[model samples]
Target chain A: MRCAKRNTILLLALLLTFAAWTSAQDEAPYYQSADFNVPIIAGWQNQSANEAAQFHKPAASATIRAAMATGADAEAAAAADLASWLGLAELTAPVYRGKVNLADGTWHVLARDIDAQRSVSQVARQAGDRFIVISFLESDPSSRIVMLAIAQADETLETAEPEMDSALEQLTGLRLDNLTAAQARALPGGEWLVYQSETALVAGSLFGNDSYIALQEGTAGDLAALADAWRGTLLGFFITPDNSPYLWLGITVSLLILAALAGSFAWRARALQKDLAMIEQLEKADAR
Target chain B: MTQHEAENPLAVRPQPRLLRALTIVSALGFAGTLVLGLFVAGTDIQQGQVQRIFYIHMPSFFGAFTAFGATVLGGIIYLWRGSEAWDRIALAGVEVGLAFALINLLTGSIWARPIWNTWWTWDPRLTSAAVMCLTYAAYLMLRAGIENPQRRRSLMSVYGIFAFISVLLTLFIIRIVPDTIHPVIVGASPQNAQGAFEATSGVVVALLPSLLLWLTLMPITLMWHRYRLALRQEAVDALKLKLLGA
Candidate 1:
């Protein structure tokens, strides 16, 4: 009977764990608007958010680093600044002669033949100084670097391109307002945001030799919520429970040790009780 | 089997004096390892000061490997001879081995970040190690969920023997597989590894004994304590049965 009871409990525990794992897997990929709303592409997981929100996709398996600028001319200013950096460094790499303008009117700076099989691209824009820079390089599979391997192993830049575009579009659409350092720091995603000053909200993600940055500006409430939602969307994928098994193992072991000690003490007490009762009974008989 | 015997169980099994001495020695040895690893070891030629993490990383891994191996040996003895002592050893080995395994994984991650530039990757070596850690944790959980003593011991013995496969896989996966980015310092890797290095004489001096002494002392100390605890629990169970029978 005891064995049967124990087995049932064990079975129930296994089922409950399975159920929880399933539910975490099934959670919607969309981040509902509490402070702000963002829908992360499926297969991504959020790692951190502050100055920049780091989103990693397990399938395309690339990390997207985002920062924001809510200043007056965010997109155009960011683009010109990046263009200047690219111009200076362009001569060192195998360069393509002309710039390719995207359908969204943003220009792309592509560095051709960086290695035998890889290229680097940076896209940036500014209206006044509300600028965001999204940069990535084609990861070569034969690269010795692990980060490059992860970026290039099976993840094609083509698959990640759409996700990047969507992120840029959402970021570009926001209206940013200036916040004091204290105000910015007080926000929910304050610590994770890229720049925590009164001017620009910039976040940067650096992987291997490449970096991706996003800038946004707006009300402190909206800025915090947006950063947090993007973080949630990117890091939403479930691989395992956050709680470590070692934690449960430690608890179980400690309890078992305590129970073992207590059981021995209890048994010794029972034996003493039995001996006292026997002595009293013998003494009563002797008196008679 | 009498009331006197029941009242005085520890009299039959005197506490081992060696346990205390071993505990003290192991504590002092560990302190020495920390001091030597931190202050005595020279900066690595390739990895700089961060390479110091290798001292604890290597020893803890070897310690975990040895503990798991001991668990296998204990399991085999229990299955063949059916001695409760052997079963106790198996239980003790897994618990102690598991602690070391965690240290190995944590320290490995700390080492990987600056060198590999990533906290974790699903390379064969790392993946296999993670699986090994999970398997042993399941072993403990399996023991905990069972109520029947004989069945618990029998099943754990078999599982303990089987679980060593993952440990072997963790150790050898990088050697066998060509695609892994994990560094193989002692032997050849088909692919270039960013963090592979030659261990200097200073590293060898600190590493070899740390591995041997920790593998010898840490598990022995933990196993001794667990063995005694198991014995006491067994005595209590026997007393309960005697009381009912009387």
Candidate 2:
């Protein structure tokens, strides 16, 4: 009866464990890659592989690709990545090039016209021996939207107003004064201050002492949605830390201790054998 | 029975069928659980591959718990019945439990070096665990020092029973102190901000089997082998005395 009760308890435990293993979540909430991990864009199609994560929005004709590239520095890494990503032998210089220091590192932000139909806006930063480049490519020919990340001019400014004024004048071909009063709009990434004119609409969101500004040539595109997506991607992206060496060391230590314990048992048994043999010889000598 | 076996009932005997079977099961279960921990579980994006050590780290603690619990049981029973076999079992438990506790300490320290940014700390839980290991280690040294057989067994039995207080302290010190960065395995998140352990399904599957194997099979098999070796040592000591006396 006791043995049966023990078997029944074991069976119950196995059953409950099996239930937990089957019912629990199998997938993590984010898309994991070799070089990094990023939140899966809810409505976008995932086409991720190797050290890169790519999300495509067919409706918007926009593709966001975050990847690890190797080169001399952030600028060179961004250029080489564009060359390989778009398969172009020679490329023209970027229309806009700047740098911003964020929580992780200094990022080099660049905007370029890949061709008449293709435009690419990318940010790159050096990570360890390589560079992490995140690009926003617009394939729609009719869309003449320009996106740029600008550094904050002052530490005291509560908003990215100074950078927004610059982005508006430089990208929209108009001064900030030409637009109406700045209106604050709460968005997914953060609070943004948007300025609008008769011909163009510009929006800038403040994040980590920098301004991520978007300017659409015409007031027809959903730049707010696009900016939210960009913020989500940027905020969610991070390089997975590698602490595998410590894991290997831990395993080595455990195995060695266990082996030593096992070896001690064998050593004792062998010594007992030698002692038993000596006892038998002593008895034989006494009988003789 | 042979003359030697009849004269000394503690002579070497053939391995039991149940013990032999348990040994086989323990070996295979260890291999299977290792594969599950190392391969089946996902790498933590925050801590990366080093997080896999947790599957072993948590289970080694439970293994030590079982071995120490056995020592307590053996001591109590030996005191009640005055059986030398139970005293041998109590001693075997100490040796086995001490080895497991060392594994637990060594692995946890190595893991903490990467996660907690330090190889050692004076946290309450860790200090108590260190003291627990040292207390049991002293039991071995004290047992060796005693020359009288009955006195050694009686004194060590009492020592083993009291040393379990350290295990109790190690198990509950986190609650008493509340400042420890060491993780509480159940019902709450870890105190250390950096050493977050997310219990994903894959990690659970690996950890459950490894936990069960180490908690039950590993300690039992090792202690049984140790117990048999102690019996042989007793027989050999008697034989040496007989020869020396002549």
Candidate 3:
């Protein structure tokens, strides 16, 4: 009993020591988010009405002739002249012109004319890929404008490929161009292309812009998937040339270790408790 | 007689003169360390005055860990050797660990506000410490839940061992992995590098004495109270047995 009493006193002393240690630490204040702002161009508008009106006017016959004077193909000249008259800064729009080939069930054109006084009329055909163009007398130059806007789809699909390619190369260290035919075949359907140029028109009346020619085509699910695939491949390249197995193995091993440790500690504790109980029972019986 | 004396088989032992003397010395040590910790320690070049909190924070962590360690060792002895003395030690250590853990957490938050620029971070050390405190608190509750003294002690001893293992893991786990959330404790700032102490003789004079005093006094105070508690528990057990016999 005396020994037990001494042990009890020693135990109490240890506790008080711990308490004193805890109380010694200082309490400080907490900090929160600092106030700041990052400026991003949310929207823009063309303030010049004259430039907006010029954008609205149809391409003139004289402008088309002058554009074609360099002996450019008629379709190319038409697109160039229209682009130049519209002051289209982006050089990416492809020029395509074909007349309706009534004889062969295809569109064929012969001797099309566009000049300074002519307006370009554009009609999207019912068939997804077909478009019709009719040249007419130019409307008032001051009021005429080619209203072009960049749509969300144009942003996602048109500009995505080049960004995806660069991101993929950074992530995977594999040049997109270097992928072998077999490797390319193995990838989910979609071919990557770099954006050369793009142009849109801002008219006087419209609040948003409009794209004249947005060039991009791929059959992958969506822009996000393309981004993910690029990121994964890049990360995978760093881990291993072939990384699927390593990722799976790493996850599996960590979970297994955690589970084993938890289970063993629990089991041992329970076993110790059982033995202690048995010892106590035996002592009680002996005392009785 | 004090109210506790009514239920205690062994009345509160009169405060021993030697113990009281030691306590006074210990109190002096605690105060000295605190003053030194606050004023004399060189300001962290990067963290400035906030870094002073480290003195308290680190010691509290050490104290809590030590207490928990004692609990585990005591628990193992209680189970293997069936020493009630070990059980008493284990109980005292757990209580002490709980108190220190609380201090560590509170002080850590105070320090965190200025340095990490947030009151709380999901940093591994902080999270693990919190978990450890909760686990030990659970151990205390488990002990309280049981009516049988032997069962409570046995169960708590096992819990104490498990809690110690968790504490070890908590301290070491973050080091082996990447954790962006918690700022690295060591080499945290290049300007205020490790052991940023610029102690004059006066500061050291005050600090060393305070540390020694607190270290010595804490155990004395706690042990004194624990002795009283053990006596009460013994008396209560005896009374129960006597009543049963009657």
Candidate 4:
């Protein structure tokens, strides 16, 4: 009887371990947007919520990751989206690869690899309502093919290529590796940096237009390892947009102000000139 | 003195040669600051190239502060003595302050784009600055709307004094308030900071006098030009009134 009870306990323990393993495998980290979601696996990071955002992994080397959020008044939302598109375009322009339409019809891909830098590669695509960008940074010699997959509710990509290419040309040689966390923290205006490290930094508004999620991953020591580590910490972290909203709002308002100022100055000068001319005419008439 | 200056006290007067020479020196000083700030300052190790924005950005704040300070002084004196000269001085201060404020705000935005990953945030310092800019802008509009000279000067003097509070708040809000994420660039300790950079001794040496001279020269040149404009406008208005009588 004693042997039978021991055997029963061992079987139960085995079953519990199996359950835990399955659950871990099933858990997919994700950031959701209005149109779709970008799902990351167990080790990817969730750094989202900015009108524009930058994500970095502290353990990873220097790399630039940016996104634009959707879900605001249409004009502001468009502005936010444009900002992200411009950033990605600039980032990939120097090492532009070919553009191809995927079989899915809803997803379009642009592939790029840096000249002479075998380890650097970037993939930018439009998936559904979100523009998804993935870049690889490994200065060391490694040709590991990394994959950043996205899963979403409504996946769709359409015809916006020619305009995108023209805009991409405007992005002439922007260095992706130079920005630091400290610099991200010190910026004024209502933008925020979500995370920072020696080699990586993430900055964006936490309350941006509610864009999609991005997952980073791959083999160890490369960019994938960092993304995996970031994903591991996502559940434990609670973050906000680090910038003051007043800064964002103030940009448009200040433009209007400067315009008014110029107008006022012009009107005053013109009016004064007219008054002077009228006075001179009257003075000559009186003398006559 | 010219006949116009002798006959009408409000005539536009030519700038004195010494003042013009000083203005020339100030222009040279501005050129020197641009050279030293862009080239001579060492690259910040942490922030990289974007850190260069601080050289001009901080000086612009100082320029605005100087102009704003003059506006306050001019306001108090105009109220106490009722001199049109002080009123003109006060108006000139506002215009120059507005120009410097714009420079301070725009350079900050450019710097923030790379470092902060966003173009602007309404942080405490930035918010206070916007308020100050709007307040002065409204002051200019108020002056434009008023037809009565005495009333316009008096109202603006009072308005200038009141608007100065925003400047003070902008300068001190980051220090007194703990809510700001904006790092203190002037009195920061060795603790790590994002968007914070150290100006090397060389940078500091180049930056200080350049900042001071920039503050001093911007107002002197701009105010001198503005005052001349105001004087000529006044004369034109008086001549218009005389012509109407004729």
DockQ of each candidate, alpha-carbon based: 0.02, 0.57, 0.03, 0.05
Per DockQ, what order, best first?
2, 4, 3, 1
Between candidates 1 and 2, the TM-score winner:
2
Candidate 4 deviant stretches above 4 angstroms = A1-278, B1-6, B189-193
- Error (Å) of candidate 4 at residue A52 is 35
- Per-residue alpha-carbon lDDT of candidate 1 for residues B21-125, written as tens digits (9 for 90 to 100): 987887688777766665666444345456666666777777778788888998999999999899988887887777777777766776777667677888788
Question: Which CAPRI tier for candidate 2?
Answer: medium
TM-score on alpha carbons, each prediction: 0.47, 0.81, 0.42, 0.51
Instruction: Write model 3 residue lDDT over A1-288, tens digit each, in one string.
Output: 999999999985775465445434422111111111111111211121221111111222111111111113434444444555556554443222333222112321222113333234221111122222111112333222121112223343443334334433433344434432311112232332222211211111111121122112121122222222222221111100122232233224423432453354346445543543454455467579
**Deviation from native of the Cα of residue A249 in model 4, angstroms:** 21
Interface RMSD, prediction 3: 18.0
Candidate 3, residues B165-236, lDDT tens digits: the string is 767866675565455354445444224222233443433334444444334455445444454455445554
lDDT for each candidate structure: 0.55, 0.83, 0.44, 0.54
Alpha-carbon shift of residue A49 in model 2 (angstroms): 5.9
Query: What is residue A181's positional error in candidate 3, in angstroms?
Result: 43
Give the native contact fraction of candidate 2.
0.76
The digit string of per-residue lDDT tens for model 2 on B1-246 reads 544556666757877898899989988998888888898776778788888999888898889899999889899999999999899889988998999899899898999997788999988878988999999999999999999999999999999999999989988887777787887766674565347666766677788889999999999999999999999889989888988898
Please give me the total number of clashing residue pairs in predicted model 3. 41
TM-score of 1: 0.47
Assess the local accuracy of residue B177 in candidate 2 as a C-alpha lDDT between 0 and 100: 75
Between candidates 1 and 3, the TM-score winner: 1
* Candidate 4 structure quality by residue, lDDT tens digits, A246-277: 33333334335444544555576567657766
